[model samples]
Target: MATAGLITWPVTLTIGAGHLLAHNKHMRLLRSFGEALEEA
Candidate 1:
């Protein structure tokens, strides 16, 4: 009972959203940094 309640839906959604947002922001920053390096 407790395992099923605590283990599934909410936790999966929370982790997925956090990872999605973080990876997107990281990619944007990496792209800008690459452009700057190329210009230099």
Candidate 2:
């Protein structure tokens, strides 16, 4: 129902945001590690 969806939208958004943040953090760490390896 619309009402249920409205209540859940914020929760869904939070979950999606967490996922994106996690993936971004992982990619950033990988890039940093690769750069460090190249330097060495």
TM-score of each: 0.72, 0.75
Report model 2's TM-score to 2 decimal places: 0.75
lDDT of 1 by residue, 8-38 (tens): 8777888889999999999999999999999
Q: Per-residue error at 18 for model 2, in Å?
A: 0.6
For model 2, residues 1-40, the per-residue Cα lDDT tens digits are 3356655767777888999999999999999999999999
Q: After superposing candidate 2 on the true structure, give the runs of residues whose Cα lies further than 4 Å from its correct spot.
A: 1-7
RMSD of each: 3.5, 3.6
lDDT of 1 at 18: 100
| Runs off by more than 4 Å, candidate 1 | 1-6
Q: Poorest 10 consecutive residues of model 2 by lDDT?
A: 1-10
Clashes of 2: 0
